[model samples]
Target: MASNVSDPAGARRPVIGLTTYLERATQGVWDVRASFLPQQYFDAVTASGGVAVLLPPQPAAQAAASVVLDGLDGLILTGGLDVQPELYGAARHPLTDPARADRDEWELALLAGARERGIPVFGICRGLQLINVAYGGTLHQHLPEALGTERYKIGGGVFAENTVDVDASTKLAGLIGAGPYGVHSYHHQGVDRLGEGLVVTARTDDGLVQAFEAPGDDYLVAVQWHPEENSADRRLFLGLVAAADAYAVSHRGVSA
Candidate 1:
């Protein structure tokens, strides 16, 4: 295999695919469905020595996912709308975001293909929920209702701050340490049932599953908080980039 990314000055910059949101947006004189991601995501990747590739919702197909992953070293399931309840055999929560069937199908396919290819993956917020659901786990749908508190989410597009305790035995603790770690959060749903083959790496005081990792050598970590929101801490991003770099080296692709 050859490097599939451009190598300038003989430096290796792993190509990381960050999933994006496909939503209706408005510009000057236009308002239509568009694909977009926050700049912080790509910035975190590039800052951590990896190239960021925005992967928007596309026609859900295993073949499409395979083709997309063929050129990438890692995959990121980003934060966004809630995962449809039907995905995990649940009913709709009145507060859950409207169904994003296309995104749901597309991301699930990408995750499956990425795992099969032994590619590193990182999930944030909604990403974590999706990963859990992918592994036969379930979500709480509404944290306020389940937890009986609005600590995880505040109104007016504000991010709440929370603390998570990492398990010393898990891989996550190795990266960020095993203790009370402060994090930025803006989500209402969280893991309900532990996913098969997934280890719980962290949790909040309320016993909400805050983080988990898959059982494998390949990098697979997911957290309920929004790490991207806190630009000061890029350890999570760096971990993914480091894994992706190794992946690119072991599984070389065509380099331009």
Candidate 2:
């Protein structure tokens, strides 16, 4: 299993599974639906001292998710399309991306499996939204409409910047330190209602929930900003990787 794989430095690197995008992609003379994720995600995991594994959308089944997670010490729900509004009993907003039902279902299943197995999980952007919905929370659907500003998402591929204040007592605060911390932003929806058992760890000046985590000692952090975008500072990835390493140690004992 990947959790047992050692780096060239002879140190064990915990296996971390990262979810990817399922989209129509084109390269060279090929245009087809593809399961892919940004290289930055992979880089962050490895740079944080963990092995990265891309988990693309698969046939959504609890059994399948369980099987997949059995080999992983940590799980990351990467950023992507908006979660289906119907999951939270709301009509789809015009600004919401067309439902990527397959991805949603698969990722949701994976999340459930992660919870059942007590695997450390990190959610980024859409990953945050899905985690909220999975816990019976609702989304604002469109932040511009809800907040009446385009600040959260300045169009174009460029990412906007925002500062969020972290609660001084949360684990996130301990990891990233107290703030008013700057972060990369590019999302149209925000958490409208916090999910059950989820503790709000950070928020922006506009009162949008920017970071949260399920209540536990085991890592389960979710941030709305794109940490992978800023490779210069990988505190979030490092936190997850550290928790993953601990999990790997406890689960299977340190691999030789």
Candidate 3:
């Protein structure tokens, strides 16, 4: 296979598609029907030596998802709206946000195709929950109700600082730098049942499922916290970029 050298570093930057939220967004003057993604997600990808592409919900995820996957080296299932309880055969929790059916449909298609292709993938807060639901797992739906406290979700755009017990055997621990590192969290819904082929790699002081991965995959990570929320920590994003770079060598695409 031939390689494309379009980047300053003399190699094509890995194309990492980051899923977005379809929402009513406001800019300087007007509100618009937009596919919104936080700057942090983009910054993290770029800072880690990969190109970030925002992927929005389409009319038919099943039809377009494979085409989208064919053009990327990696995927980032980002954080956003709650996963509809019905997705995992559960009753709707009163506190859970109404389902974003379009996003659910689109992202799940992307995930299915990516998994089939062995594409590297990373999942953040809501992303983690979606991963669980994707693999026949369940979510707590509401941590406050289950734990009787809002420790996992301290609102006001605040990032809670908590320690996670990382398993030394997992890739997450090696990439996380130090042991028992404090992470930024913002969700209440957490992984309850272990997804098929998924193993726990990290946990919180309260024993919440903080991170997981597919054991034999080159790169497949899901975290209950938000690494993109804090730009300072580039470890997770760097890991994705590294995996994506390797993926590109095998699944070549146009230079980003």
TM-score of each: 0.95, 0.96, 0.94
Tens-digit per-residue lDDT, 60-149, candidate 2 = 466678888989999999998899999999988888899888889989999998887778999999999999999999999988889999
User: Ranking by lDDT, best first?
Assistant: 2, 1, 3
Query: What's the lDDT for all of these models?
Result: 0.88, 0.89, 0.86
Compare the candidates by lDDT and give the number of the best one. Answer: 2
Worst 10 residues of 2 by lDDT: 1-10
- Write the residue-wise lDDT of candidate 3 on 129-183 in tens digits: 9999999999998998877878888989898887788888788987885368778
- Could you tally the backbone clashes for each prediction? 8, 0, 0
Q: What is the per-residue lDDT of model 1 for residues 83-118, given as tens digits with 9 covering 90 to 100?
A: 999999999988889998888998999999998888
Query: For this target, which candidate reaches the highest TM-score against the unseen true structure?
Result: 2
Clashing pairs in 2: none
lDDT agreement of model 3 with the native: 0.86
